[model samples]
Target: MSGWLPVAPCTPRDCAGHRGARRGPLPAAVLLVAGSALTLLGVLCVPAVQLLGAAHRDRLIRRWAYTVVRAFGVRVLVTGERAEHSAGELVVANHISWLDIPLVAAVLPGRMLGKREIRGWPVLGPLASLGGTLFIERERLRALPDAVHAVAQALRSGSRVVVFPEGTTRCGRGPGGRFGPAVFQAAIDAGATVRPVRVSYRSTRRGPVGVDGAPTGPCGGPSADHSGHTGAVAFVGDDPLAASLWRVVTAAGLTAEIRLLPLIPADREPGRRALARAAQNAVASDSAKRPAVSVHQ
Candidate 1:
């Protein structure tokens, strides 16, 4: 085991362990204490954190969040070069995992909308608030105006903004893998071009099959994952945070691949289901079409 691991198991178990070391620790005590402290402090500094302009604050918060995610060991693999979009353009992509934030932030390097709970997280929360991320509490519904404003303000300020219209992770299965039409309103409201991106993780591209990961293709998989329970980084808006974090902490490093495509004009914005279908295709298309893994896998 020792000798093989040193060689890099190229297997999920080893990959998971590497991820644990990167994310920090696996025990609840560590996360609990750290998370609790941060939560408390974020509340205390709420007023001060809100002082910066949304873009300025979220820039800082995103940096902090990306760092923390990196420290946990989730490496982002981006492909199909990211094109510059006008300030009001909305960057849309599939929601694959919770770690999507750091994974995307590492390269996309922009402001995004997060769940309300993320806004309430301790040091990280305030840091995010300051970084210009708009944290929305869906249950409250009334907060939609504020959330929209934050996104609008960011774009209006000439900063790029992003949204995950899937509204949740596919968990790699079934109907909802497609993006919901309701979520599309944000980009329309902002009058932004729709730049679609694709994302996926594979067990191996150069390695063997023993460590099978989710298989994706130009049109999503002909393959299937019947074990359809949510993955560690549940992208679904409703998964419990504690459980989600636990899964992410315990999982191995993901070979994330992102393909950023051209900006579609409002006149060209694909209808409800088509938008997600386009992205889904893009994610796999980029990977399958690659002559080589151009970006780090």
Candidate 2:
């Protein structure tokens, strides 16, 4: 049992199929179903997340969300140093696998901002909404104003709003994966602090990479990398609620790392791309240092 734990970095074969292979070897399909069911249950409970009560309840929702999928046998390893966060911050992260949902949720103690499609998901979406998730539809310029307003309101109202400003996920070592400027404008308008987060997946079950960096299926977002021992990976925009959930269950084996960078706040009345660049640099640098699949994708 102790051997399953990671001591430090080694070759691809070292950690392959050891931890996941253990546990009496359940079928991948079985684990997938189990994980999916737990997630569905969490979704069904979304309403309770909102109705329940205080910040503590919200934290419970996020933690439980992470736990439900974790039952599938995916290990999450959080690395890099976390930056100090001030009140009313807007956290931005490089979107990757669906495992990212919990990775970021684990670190943030505030409301999450997701795409509108999420609100329509079977059970998970509702749970997310009830859990104080802010939903915005893509390419809706008209709605951008409202979305910004909601984010501002959330921040001023004493609730932090975490936004994945790349707008969607993508595959790249770069911090830019197709960013949306409207949200940045919103932050400037609201005078909120922006923090960047980078999410990555390294295998513990398969060899090096889990899958290719190229997206798979109708990936609602970024597809996790798959390198049977090759160390390949895939990053995409955002996945439909279902596919994201499946990534965890079907993963041959892997560890997810979510690194939080220093928060960049809106001080002056107007902030520029420079500020955004600053935040991006912080996130990219720290994220690059963390281990996983290829840094190339």
Candidate 3:
């Protein structure tokens, strides 16, 4: 394995497939069956996530996430090592698809800070709250101070909090606006370690699962990108959540790439702004030699 790099830039064309024309929804029969199965799984797992203790909760969360990703037919490609988080450590990552939540959770398994809107998202809302997500009303400026304080306290108490500093979803093709410096104060206040991460998605092709429940293809693997790669899972703009869900379920070879950079010691920075700049630069710089792909031997 290689050491983490400060910069990793992605090409704009990498996100082209996501913005392409909508292909409509999947077959109603397939959608109905899949939706029912997923809802049943969610209902069964939410209680375990809530009633269990920390270690058990995190393990269950990881298993739930892994099952859901595979159910959606999404493949993950990770770059860099899984962070060994210290108490009060802050994880900052770029936001792309709603899929980013489970993908990141699958690897990091921490409490997340999400916009208030997610709290009302049907079955997901209740599960998220039970799973320890902290909800914030980002639009209410007056509430910002208190929220930051609460986050800081959580950090100080030895909780791992994941925050998407961009404040809104953006294409993974490139970095969005500067990382909002407001939340960095939490890291500074708690003297927490700050870690930056980058996530990107791409598409490829493979044959459908067969009666034997085995993936079959010419080489029994993803086809070359040049042959066929469809962005069946990009969520941006006003794209409806339902549309993105349909895309992910029906498409083959959808992959999410997550790159975790080196961690920054909070005390080394003079203030939150300086720390924020360093963290942003660490995630924004596309200087990593090449992203390492996870492949089964």
Candidate 4:
């Protein structure tokens, strides 16, 4: 791997932990089938969806993405105010699971900036290509500038470009990895606004009771509980796609919360490094009190 390519230390054995609370084999099997069917349906409908006007297309994309997440038995709780839809905005979020892709699209449907490898995934590859994903060669240091230029062109052409600036998936237990500055340069190049979104996973099942007999917040760490189900959603180092998919389908009551922070104007930032830092800080700051959870099916 190139020295510039970002790599996360998390692995399935150490960070993913146990399988946690799972649905019965039958129910899990059903969920897996449904999720796969939905994904294939999306792939089939791409041509028809492209024929619709931009406004209508976006609505369908959002609804389809939301249903896909629901089909996998994951509940979504979106907090924080979402910025009004506009052209040339950069949507950046912390990477954890493959679910993050559709999760973000459900709320903010846009052209995704993904690893070049995703272009070869089974059902998702064609859909990503038809949906206008920008693929970058993450392992080649020489490709960095060209990738940034491609993103800049997309933004300049009035497309909302979604990216995972962390460069790779993390375990989502704590602050995972730093946002790379390279992608931020595209925002600066196009004078686009940067929207930092934070993604966190939690098991809906309550943890162990405290000394006072009330359920305590997350057993031993910031997220996940005794079951370790929430952490299992993470697709980290060396975890096969098939295994991760099975884990997601079997896990019970897995909830993904997306926090949308205020937007930062790229022009106002001194440079890409500073912009990356500001966005990272905004995402890392989870100081706000928990709002009433609104489950999006």
What TM-score do all the candidates reach, one by one? 0.60, 0.71, 0.78, 0.90
Candidate 2 error regions (>4 Å)? 1-26, 51-55, 82-85, 172-175, 205-247, 268-272, 286-297
Best-matching candidate per TM-score: 4
- In model 3, the runs with Cα more than 4 Å from the true position are 1-36, 205-231, 289-297
Candidate lDDT values, in order: 0.51, 0.56, 0.66, 0.81
Better of 3 and 4 by lDDT: 4
- What is the clash count for each candidate, in the order shown? 18, 27, 6, 0
Better of 1 and 3 by lDDT: 3
Q: Model 1: residues >4 Å from true position, as ranges?
A: 1-70, 140-150, 174-176, 205-243, 270-293
Better of 2 and 3 by lDDT: 3
Name the lDDT value of residue 234 in candidate 1.
Answer: 40
lDDT of 2 by residue, 116-181 (tens): 888887666766777778887554656767987888887776667777665545433333443445
> Which has the greatest lDDT?
4
Local accuracy of candidate 1 as per-residue lDDT tens digits, 1-297: 221011211222211211111233544446545544544554465477568785665565545544545444344555565555466766777665656665666556566777777777756676576656767766655666676667766666667677776554554333334454443455555565667766554322222212224334222232223222223344443545565566554444445556666566544545634654555455445243443235542
Candidate with better TM-score, 1 vs 3: 3
Whole-model lDDT for model 1 versus the true structure? 0.51
